[model samples]
Target: MLAFRIVILAAFAVAAIAFPRAAIAAEESCPGLVARRGLPIVPASLAADAVQLTYIGHSTFLFETPSGVRIATDYNDFVRPRTTPDVVTMNRAHSTHYSDNPEPGIKRILRGWDPAGGPARHDVQFGDVRIRNVVTNIRQWGGETTLRDGNSIFVFEAADLCIAHLGHLHHTLTPEHLKQLGRIDVLLVPVDGSYTLDLDGMMEVIASINPRIAIPMHFFGLSTLDRFLARAEGQGFTVERRPTPTLTLSRTSLPPTPRVLALPGR
Candidate 1:
């Protein structure tokens, strides 16, 4: 009986180790490729010399320029005025981080969309904008103590400026993540303090990215906003709270030093 129990335990341990690696490998496979198979590739729908962005609410953003290139990040449900974006990227960390169904007519959808066994990786170009997604640690709903599908950090580049959005990021980025990040001009970051990393860790991330412009999102209210601004200011970052929700930007508009812009979400 004792010998049988030992063999059973050994088998169970090996199975556990083998299963996670297999799951991770499986989850890391591409979903869009599976969905589309091998169809002819169509070019993105965007124009040259146009770049603009707006903070809708939470992690939702509307980016379009005079030339009409639109993109959104973490566009979950409950968007006011029901603003639809040309491209929507979602990370399934929680309900707030994703929408059950995005508004109709969305041209492309990228969900970190990994199946239940692994991480996600993809490079996408929408219009003139180029986007790259890298999978980070997978976390539970509300990120409260469990891990599921690994979250994704997206880098968006257009009109000579690069923007990165860290979606529901629950831990500090690894060196591999930094290598994937490359250079970031503008960073749309979450400052909720608890759900994401705390203020100090966030400060460290900002220092690492060293973006010319830093925009805070996912924070609760004025106080949380204030804490973030205070930290940025101490780091010698100029804080600008744009009265207008939408702002047009270009490579020329990007500054040399780090600046934090707080846009009002409605």
Candidate 2:
């Protein structure tokens, strides 16, 4: 009886190890982007499938998925949302975009910069949401020198929607960057003009991405935001200004044409 029990225990251990390895292999073979075929069409009554976005001030925006996963972009000490986020993505372009000391409650803290000066790589999966990044360069503060792979464009995929947050992007994206970004349904852009990319450069970036909805962030005040809105309008984008800073969006609920949404800061 003792010999039979030992054999069964060994079999269970081997099965446990082999199952995880097979799952990992399967996940590795899958493509990075979600395919757009055979997906169920979300109905008007099923607004619960939408993802919620809330502006937290500056570049910080809180994203809540349908499965209750919360993510905060450009997380910093100042302008933090009232509720704790399950995951936080930070950029080190300036103090306003990142925090050295993050709240202990956060499950995952994804930094856009590598301490070793290499590119920051992240492809994390939490519940129904998947987060990844495409590295980009930025100009050093008060200098003409450029830092390679200094910042990241974080991509969040949930509920059949692909959302991208451009963190302190300084220049136009290259072909490789575009290839890596794949299809972005929604975009969170920085319209600070001087601090990030200039108005013209940013406009070009937006054109290249061509997201279904563009939400402006990282701007100082209304003036900068208005300038971006005006330029985007010239490019045939409809502008919708919201009284509140929160919006719930889904794939089926997306506008027939691309539009710019202005959400007031809370």
Candidate 3:
């Protein structure tokens, strides 16, 4: 516990010094902007240059692009949307995060781990939206053995927006991972506290990503979600509790200061 606390403290100090200025400067339209709480989020109509993200539940999200392509993240049987999506991405960390039997009519099923015994690699283009992935490691059930290249962090590029869905992430990203990530506008992150990275390490991951907007998911209850929200607030990020489950953001709608947008869902 002491060592964990020390890591948190060190991370806090580093984040306090590094993230704010960098996140602000990340967007040209956001420089010299002041951070504020309760930033207004306009319900996105998904304009010509925008994309939409609707939280289904858990780590699953339905991403709709302007060109009419749909992508589902963490395509599990437990929390799939009613309508089949054009493409689906899944992680193998848990049974609830992926499905053994996906719908045959579904166009593409991008699993994080390859069934043939290797890391999954994907770079598929769907209309104006392009989907790709960066492989990451995961801890097996009960935190026993660490599996190398067992999971994926999928990035969606649409309407000039870069959104990343970190599926069942168990560890902080390496420098190489960040290099592949580049700049991210929105992030879908897990905040289960125990199942994925604890609040401390998760915050560390957010600092490393420095996304303009972050929406928390993969939590079992409200309290677990609140802890992650509080951690982001402590790191000087503005927290916005959206009344709706869907969040729409384009380059023009991106927040100047980094923000944690809490959409209502699982």
Candidate 4:
């Protein structure tokens, strides 16, 4: 198993929480590769200035850069891409959000939490992609415990675009976090209202990041996704539910106004 937070929980009472999942059981360790339940994964051949993305399900997304470097976010046991990626990012909120055993072909495995008792720090330049992270706090043991450096918001820079995945984020970004993130072209966010931050706080986070495009993820089902779409529409942001979960975009293809694109996936 990859390193997990097993230290004693903090005695301090948390005022709020981060992420909580319904199911908990012994994890089934497997190669984080192979087709997900036999779903066909179309091979990507991106242009020199474009990026291809597939919403694998939940918080997991497979991103192919212009240079053919592949990256997977929130790689876990339940969801993943068919082809092995060069890099994989995992969040430790629960088993559904991370994998106990990642496949061997993956060159870089970035964990949101550090087992050495501090925030995770990463800034890697691989192939044609530059990936980094900003540490955040999380609530553990069902909101009663606090882990100061529990979560991470990973930012990937490639093809002259900045992409971010908000992994089980608990709170809004502070000035420092925003500064570290710089400018994001596309953002992958969580919209499961109760588990992560509430809808309103998530909206606030979106505003703070102010990405050109925002895509909702970790929404367990359609009702949850619909709720987020309605919330986004009410906030004056444009909302569009795409016909497919697969996409390819570039810096020049961004919408005139910030828009929320709901890609169908688990």
* TM-score for each model: 0.77, 0.83, 0.83, 0.82
Residue pairs with backbone overlap in model 1? 23-117, 27-118, 138-150
Q: Write the residue-wise lDDT of candidate 1 on 1-70 in tens digits.
A: 0001000010111111110111122222222222112332333332243356778888877776333556
Which prediction has more favorable TM-score, 2 or 4? 2
Model 4 is weakest, by summed lDDT over 10 consecutive residues, at: 1-10
* 251 Cα displacement, candidate 2 (Å): 0.5
Per-prediction CA RMSD (Å): 17.2, 15.6, 10.2, 14.2
The TM-score between candidate 4 and the true structure equals: 0.82
Runs in model 3 deviating more than 4 A are 1-45
lDDT (Cα, tens digit) per residue for candidate 4, span 81-158: 888999999999888778889999999999999989899999877766778898998889476687899999998877
Backbone collisions counted per model: 3, 0, 0, 0
Winner on TM-score (1 vs 2): 2
Q: Please give the distance, in angstroms, between residue 115's alpha carbon in candidate 2 and its true position after superposition.
A: 0.9
Ranking by lDDT: 2, 4, 3, 1
